[model samples]
Target: MKKVVLAYGPRGFGNYTFDTETLEFSGSPDTRSGPLIIPGFIDIHTHGAFGIDFMSATVDEMRDLCCELSKVGYEGFLPTTVTAPVAQVRQALARLPDDPMILGFHLEGPFISPRYPGAQPQGDIVDPPVGVSEWDPILDDSRLKVITLAPERPGGGDLIRRLSNRNVKVSIGHTEATYTQCREAFAMGARHTTHTFNAMRPLHHREPGAVGFALTENDVFTELIYDRHHVAREAAEVLLRCKPESRVLAISDSTMAAGVPSGTHLKMWGLDCHVSEGTVRLADGTLAGSAITLLDAFRNLKEDFGWSTAVNACCINPRIALGLSTTEARTYLELDPDLNIVARYDRKK
Candidate 1:
C-alpha cells in the first residue's frame, strides 16, 4: 500500500505519513500534499445534527449523521444522550448500528443533578442505578466511553467508581456539586468534565465548585464548547491560560437543530427550541446548544488565538482526552493561511 504524506506548516511540524489502505500512520514523512495538513477532528460530545437526535434516531438516521459529520472533517464522535429513562437510553444504544465514525456513546444523562439540569428535561434527572449488575447493558458495551453525572446525587460516587473500574471514563457535569464534592469525585477517578462552566455550579471565591475544581485539578480534562455563544472569547482565554492546553478539549455539544435554516424550530428532548442567528435557544431564550461545526470552531479559534492553540484544542486535545492513538488514520486537511479548508484527503474503507 502506498503511504500518503501530509505536509502542513508555517508553524512547522514537518510531514505525517499514513498507509492509505489501513489509515494508520507510517511515521516517516514523504510528500503527497503540502502547505497545511491536519488530522480529522474527534468530537467527543454532540447530540445530533441536521435535525436528528441520537436519542430517537433510527439506524439509518444514525449512519446518516456519521456521513454528514465526515464531510465536515470529523473522523470520529460520541453520540451524546440527554437525560432520559434508562429503558429509552438503552433502546437508542441497542438500535444504533456500529458505524466507523462513531467512536462511542457519551452518556450525558439521568445520573445528573436536577438543579443544574440546563437544557436537559428535569423530569428525567434521577439517581443512577445502584445495583452492580443493574446497568450491565451499558457497563458491558465496549462503546460506552464516557458518562457524565453529578457527584452530589445519591449513589453517584459508587457509580463513578464502578464505571471507572470497568474502564469507562467518567466525566462530572450538569451539577451543583460543591468544591468538596467535585474533589471527591475527582479522587474517585472522574477525570473529565463535560462542557465545563455551562451546566455546573459557577466559580465563587468562597465556593469554587466544579468549574474551579476543573481548573485547579491539573489531572482533570476540561471540555469547552468554544462557539462564542457557549463560552465568551474572554472567558475562553482565561481557561486557556489557566489550564494546560493539552488538558483542555473543544467540543460542539451541538443539538440536532444545527445546520438547518436559522429560523427552523426544533423539538428537542420534548422541549421547544429554535435555531436563531446561528444558535439554538429555548422559547424563553436559554441557550440550547451550538449550530457551529467542528470546522467552524477551529476557524473561530484560529482567528482569535492563533494556529497552534486552535489546532491543539480542536485536534490534538481531544485525542489526548480520549487516549486515542495516532495510528488511527492517515486522513489530513489542506488548510489555507487563514485556516480555511482548501482541500482534504480522506481515508475511506
Candidate 2:
C-alpha cells in the first residue's frame, strides 16, 4: 500500500487530514501540498441513477450504475427497493450486482401505508404480515441493511422488533403515525426515519407527528434528502438547527433520472417521469424521486448549511446509521474549496 495523506482547510478552522490506506483522520494541521480529502460518500437511500432503476435492472445494468456512481465519488451505497410485488422485490434482490460499492440493500416498501405513499405504487402497498416467516427469503439475507415501513400498519411494531432482533435497521416512513405511535414504534426497535418529512405525516402543533418525533427524539436518526427540489433550503436549515448533528443523515433518494439531461423522460414505478429544471416529476406533476446524487447533497448541505453539518450528515452519520465497519479499504474524494472533486484516492486501487 502507498503512504497517502490528504489535507484540507486553512488556519483557525484547523486542517483535516485523512489516511487513505487506513481510512482514519488526523486533526493536526499539516503544511502538505495535497488536495482536500473527505470521506467517500455513503448514500443509504438511493433507488437508481444514470437512467437505471434497481427494480428492473439486470446484473450488468446494476454494475453499470455502480461504475457511474463511482465517478461522482460514492465509495459505498445501498441499492434501495421501491414498493413492488413481493415476487418482483425478491427478483430484484437476487439480481443485485456484487459490486464493491454495494454495501447492502435498503428495502423501502410493500409494508408502507397507502395513505402517505408519496410517488410509491399505491396498488402494491400493504400492511406487514402477522409473522416474519412469510418474508424469510429477505430476512434471512445478511445483506439486508435497512427496511423502511409504516409502523402504524398491521403487525408493524412486531415486524420492527423482529427485524431489529436480527440486527437489521428498521426505519419509519410513508405513514400517518402521530407522535405517540412513532414513540411506540421507536420503543419497539425502529431507530430511523425515511426522508424525514416527505411521505409521513406533517408536524402539527397539537399532533407532533412523525416529523416532530424524529426531530425531538435524539436517539432516532433522520434521513434528509438535500436535493433543493425535494427539500427547500430554508426547511433544511431548520432541520439542521433542530436535529442533533449526529442524528441527521443526508441521502440522495435519487432515481433513474439522475445524471441525465433535463429533457430526458424515463419510465419508473408505472409512471412517466420527466426530468427538467433540476427536478423529477410524473405526468400528473407529482414530485418523483430526486435527480441529485449524494455529491450534490453534500455540496448543497455545505453551501446551504456549513461544513460541519455536511460532514456529519453525508459521511459520519451514514456509517453509524447502518452500523457498518470501516476496517476495510476506503476511498476518499479530494475536493477543492469550491467543493469540486478534483481528484480521488482509493486505498484499494
Candidate 3:
C-alpha cells in the first residue's frame, strides 16, 4: 500500500490512522497519518459490473459479480433489470440471488414511456396499468423493491398507486409529463426519480418538467450518475443546491461493459454498443449506460463536494433510500494517503 497523504472524514485529511497489520482505521484529524477509510457503499440502481448483465446472468454469475464489486467498495446493491417482454422480465427476475450483498431487485422498465426511452428498447416499453394476471407475479415478489415508470401513460396513476400500496418504491422517469402531472404522480406514491435529468423531460424555464420537480421537491429522492458524462458537475451543483443531501443519492446505471476493457463492443438490448472513454454508447452515440462503479462516482463527487458530502451521496443515502439501516455497512474500503484503493476488509463474515 502507498504511504499516507490524506484521510477523508468530517474534518478531511491527516486526521486518521490505519494499521495495515491490524487493518484497523481510526480518525479525527489528529491521529497519525494513514489510509482513508469509509464504509462500503450500497448501490440501489446498478445494472451489472465486471462483464455481468443482471438481465441475463444466472444466479451464480450474479454472485460472482457481487464478489468482484466487494473488491472496490460496495457492500450491497440492487440487481436492476431493464425493459423486456413480460415473460422475459419475469424469467430474469426469477434469477435474483438470495445473497446478503444483493439488497433487492429493481424493475427499471416495461412500464415506461416510449418517448423518453433513453437506451431502453422502444419496442419493449409498456404503458401504465399493467395487466394484473401477468404482472401480479412480479409485484408479488417480496424482493421487488423499486419500479421506474412514466406516470402520464394510460393507467399510469393506477399503476403507481398499486406499486406504492405494496411498498414498492415508485420512481418517475422516461416521460414528457408536465409539472402538474409529475406532482400528481408524487401524490400517488412516487417518491423518487430515476437517473434524474437523463431520459426525463428537460427542465423548461416556464414548464418546470419532471427534472425541475425532482430538484425542487424536498421529499423527492433523486438518483444521479456522476460519471462526468451522464451528468455534468454544474448540473449536480444545481441539484444539490435545491435538495437536501439526504434526498440526493448516486447511482451507476452501469452496463455489463462498465468494468470491461475500453473499446470492447457488445450487443446490448439488440443494439451494437462499444465501451469507450468509460462510457457504453450506441452507434449513433446515445449513451447505453455508464462504465463506472460507485467508487468512481465517490471520487468524482469528492472532487466537487467535500469528503463528508461524497460519503453521504455514495454510501449513506442509497441505503437510506432502500429503508435499510445506514449503520449496517461493516465492510471498509482502505485507501492510501492519496485516496487510492489499497485494500478492503469485510468485518462481517
Candidate 4:
C-alpha cells in the first residue's frame, strides 16, 4: 500500500509503499493519492478530556485520559493543573504515574493575575513563587514542566528567571501587561506564551500588548488553541504570517467539558462551566479553556491553513518546546482521503 509521508520533509508529501504483511515500506515513491502519515500529536497544555480533570484526577483516571487521547493519535501529553492552592497542586502532581505517554505537568497557575483569571479558580490565585517558603513544595516536583503566570505581578520576573535557570518553561499568560513588560519578561527568561490572545491584554496601535510580542517574536513559542471559537481565522492568520512554523505551538487547552455535548454543565476544577457549540466557558461567559483535542486542532488548521501548518503546530512544535527528541518521535497516524485517522502506531522503536 502507498502512503504519503510529510514528517521527513515539510516542503510537501512524498509517496512510499508499505508491505501489508510486514508493516514496513517496500517500494519507492510515486505521485498519487494515498494515506497521509504525520507525526503523532504532543499536547503540552491539556487539563483533561473525556470527563476527567487533571486538577483532581487519580493516577488511574489519568491513565484513562491517555487511553482516550491515544485513540485520536496522541503520542504524549502533559497533565495540566488549573489554579489551586499550593498544597492542592502538590497532590495533583504527586498522583501522576511514570508512564511514557505522560511527558510532564503544566501549572496554569496559582501565580496569575486576579484581573484576568479567566475561568481559573479566582480565590485560589496566589503570588509567584519566591522559592523560600515551606508552602512551595509544588515547585520541587520533578515532573513540573511548564508554569504560566502574569509577568506584571510582583516576583513574576524573579520566578521566570528561576524556572528558566532550571530549564522549566515559563509561559506568560493571565496578564494585563504591556508590550514593554512582555519584552522584559522575555529578556528575563520567559520563552512561551500560554494560549495567546486569550486571558491577556489585547493589542493596541500605540502599545502592542503581549499579543503583539507573541505575534512578532521569532524566538518565543506561542500556544494557539486552534478551536475556531478560541481564536478567529484572521487572528490566527496574522500569527502564522509573523512567526515561523517552528515557533507556533498549537495546544489543546481542553478541560473536562471538552468533547461533551453542548449545554452540558460540569464543575471544572471547582468552577462551574458548560460547553456551547464546542467552546467551554464559565457561568459569567469567560472562556474556561477549550473543547478540542489535537486531532480537532489538526483538522481545523489543516482545513483552514495548510497541511504543513497542521503538522508543525499540532505534532512537532510542542515536542520542540518541551525539548523532546524529534528524530525519535514515534506515534504516527494513517489517514484516509478524507483525513480520518484509520490507523495509529509508533514510528520508531
Name the candidate, 1 or 2, with the larger lDDT value.
Answer: 2
The TM-score, computed over Cα atoms with residue i paired to residue i, of candidate 3 is 0.90
Model 2 scores what on Cα lDDT? Answer: 0.84
Q: Which 10 consecutive residues of model 3 have the lowest summed lDDT?
A: 1-10
Q: Which pairs of residues collide in candidate 4?
A: none
In candidate 2, stretches whose alpha carbon ends up further than 4 angstroms from where it belongs are: 1-13, 16-27, 30-34, 325-329
Give the alpha carbon lDDT tens digit for every residue of 1-349 in model 1: 5434454322234565544454445454544454566877888999999888899999999989988987888878999988887789899998788777888899998889888888999997888778765566876788899999999999899999988997788999999999999999988989999898899999999999998888888888899998889889998898888898778888999889878899998888899998998899999999977787788888888888876777778777787777875434435666777666666567775
Q: Residue 175 CA error for candidate 4 (Å)?
A: 0.8
In candidate 4, stretches whose alpha carbon ends up further than 4 angstroms from where it belongs are 1-12, 17-32, 347-349
Query: Each prediction's Cα lDDT score?
Result: 0.82, 0.84, 0.83, 0.83
Clashing pairs in 3: 5-337, 15-29
CA displacement after TM-score superposition, residue 251 of candidate 2 (Å): 0.5
Candidate 2, residue 218: the lDDT equals 92
lDDT of 2 by residue, 25-91 (tens): 6565655545566667899999999989999999999999999999998989999999988889999
Give the backbone clash total of model 1.
0
Please estimate how well model 4 matches the true structure, expressed as its whole-model Cα lDDT. 0.83
Stretches off by above 4 angstroms in model 1 are 1-12, 15-34, 132-134, 327-330
For lDDT, the strongest prediction is 2
